[model samples]
Target: MGSTHAPVDLSSEYAADFRAHQRTLRLGAMTVWPSTVQPLLSRRTAKLVRCSDPGTYNLTLVLEGTARASWDDREAEYRPYDLHSQNSWQPCTVQVGQNDQIVRCVGVEIPRNLVALPRNSADRAIGRPLSAREGVGALLAGFLTRLIADTSAYRATDGPRLGAVLGDLVSALFAHTLDSGRELSPEAHRRTLTLSVRSFIGRNLHDPDLTPSTVAAAHNVSTSYLYRLFQDENVTIGALIRRERLERARRDLADPAQHGVPVHEIAARWGFTHHSAFTRAFRAAHGTSPSDYRQARHQPTSIPERASGGTPTGSADQVM
Candidate 1:
């Protein structure tokens, strides 16, 4: 991730955050980088990288602002926390808004063979903006954010095994994002089932009746299959539902436009019908009541880093 200085007209902070995600890799070559730049229309650069190493699937999480990605028949706009995939072997371009604005993104380059997904499925996912807030996308995004934020925690001894697990998850996420009904080998079916469940749950989060039974019934899977699918998640469907709701609520509460909206109303909007219950849950998850969290966010400066909706400090990766 090379650093390019911005035009003199723009704020110099443009390139400052560019350096955050470019930290050196301690985990083999899984370098994490947080970057804010325009589509690098540089064939020579892409070619040089291709010559040096195996082609990769570049996965990105837009940490702040928005960016547009285009490749083949697939072209899409991605926003903050949205995940998207691109193949390093092909020519692609991604650009952000003008007016000196910068779009922050966190990216990781996965060697193509390490992804474990079929070529067709990965192609379908390319340039598609996957929902990072839910499903396999959620699980993968969260893990990536943690890993990038704390790369030092990972020892060289953990490399091969963790890399395999990472590949498996990335495969599931790509398959889930595309939802392309390509027949898979027997080995893929088990991972496919869990991905389907998570996607179904994410789509139906607004339905207060989105219980495990309803989820299983909708997917034509028995409750037992649903249970087996999520065993690796270490969280129940109910817990996931609540966590997703609270995350959405946290983003809304931090938004200035939503300041006029009542805290209880915001909770109900995300499927929490009971005010007291929502408050309790919010406090339990955030270590403070929803009202207080919102109040703190609006107090002018010194807003909590999470409330800012920007890339976290000391982010380890950036996308070109």
Candidate 2:
């Protein structure tokens, strides 16, 4: 599916009559824009938001300006390209700068079941403004941009998959924010630990020796608890390791620089040791043999044939 609506001109269309012109568009179960306006937001005074009904969570991305956002008596200035999420039910104010600013944001109403934290949790999480500068924030920004760009593909049938992506992104962002500040609680600690473990696993994908015992020891947690941590994520330790390793191999194979590297070496670099075993795994994962993949990447027209007797593997992609 794709968007049929023309690009919106919020500045001219809703510049005046702020109350009636506030636009809200539903994108799947989530709402994309709720009462968004460029003019109603300014730097001179704090803008108080009155939701039609209590919303779950308000996700905002700073498209082209800087401003300070305040929730539950805490505040922080957000610069261009920064992303922030807030609990909409709580009374909050956003202060913009003197220059006209443009912001593109999407707010997702937090589901009832996930909001079962103690009363202070929301306050603690939103009280101090959170910035999406790294980790989950970086992933969330990319995911949300992709989501909004391809709304049709993220329909009812794809809800579960999309929801999982959203959950992981948000979990990572909030967990990072809470841990960096002094306000993290016991529950927050657990959530942050889970995200950290996942991130560590991702960064160590090339290490063939990465294992449950290694991960558990790195985090100073027992093997049983590490398994338990991933239970809620619908995956196991072994599953994550495999997924990361395969993903890395796929990326390296696709790189033009690797046109000469032997498939066996590529596999070994990412943990696979045996030539036959790596070929089988690559075929199963990518539906193509490693030699075929290399040949396809180095088609005669795309890559010049080596002069004399130089092996293709002697080029950039090969192991020295």
Candidate 3:
């Protein structure tokens, strides 16, 4: 990818090797760029080559620090944890701050065909900010962030599977931004809900009150409906929540920094209420009590979490 850039200050031609790491799955790709001061990447009309690969809708997620983007008659500001989508075919400029502010992000590109939205509807959404504060947006953000942070935890077999999930997430997110004006297919609708439920669960992991009923209420769905949705996955919503909570607690216990935090406190931090109940659950889940698990130098690992996807919306493939 021979991409070129110019400094925002117009002081001179931009020249800097910014520290950016990128990874590509079968259907989606993620690129992480550490914060930098200058050399903003610019893709103008002269650069969106017609002979390149099909264009995609790329979502730039600002994990840390603030940044900005510009494209076809539009400009958008992004801060930490903000997901901003743009058309890969459209020319754009992405700029970040200087001073080693440490801006890091994972970009997910969604193929246009996979998005299932009208061209105009899709166009209307470019470069707009999608906050990871609540709803499906938060869920997708968490999934993408986790995927980038723990890519090694995923096996080759999980690629296509995650891609499909990523597509569903993108559809849901697009629909969300479109409000009720947009229509999602039956399958996309169900999947969107499932991902929403999953996202809800993830966001509220610390809340002991995060139950199926509460989650259903948040999404305006019945508890039974929510249960049915996750039923076939062989993972009850309760089980998923418990699994996530336990996993989080287990990791916290394993951390030497958390050593001073008591076992009961740690359990409660992840939603466990009763000390005995928490201890029992911890022991049952990890084959040892939280206290012992924390004290032990190397605790036996448990099951890893699953993943999700997005698509390519960048690179005309030439930028020397």
Give lDDT: candidate 2, residue 119.
38
Clashing residue pairs in candidate 1, if any?
Answer: 21-33, 21-34, 21-317, 32-316, 32-317, 33-316, 33-317, 33-318, 34-317, 34-318
TM-score for each model: 0.53, 0.59, 0.72
Report the C-alpha lDDT of model 2 over 1-320, residue by residue, as the tens digit.
01111111122334554332223334334444422335333211122233132446556766555667665446677775576556645555565433444444544545423433443554455644555555657666656565555343333445544554455455545655566323334454566567667777877766778899999998889999999888978999988887777778777877888767777788888877677877887788778887786677667575465677532322111111
By lDDT, the candidates rank as: 3, 1, 2
Please list the Cα RMSD from the true structure of every candidate, rounded to 1 decimal place.
9.5, 11.4, 7.0
Models ranked on TM-score: 3, 2, 1
lDDT of each: 0.66, 0.57, 0.68
Of 1 and 3, the candidate ahead on lDDT is: 3
Best by lDDT: 3
Model 2, residue 252: displacement in angstroms?
Answer: 3.8
Give lDDT: candidate 1, residue 26.
30
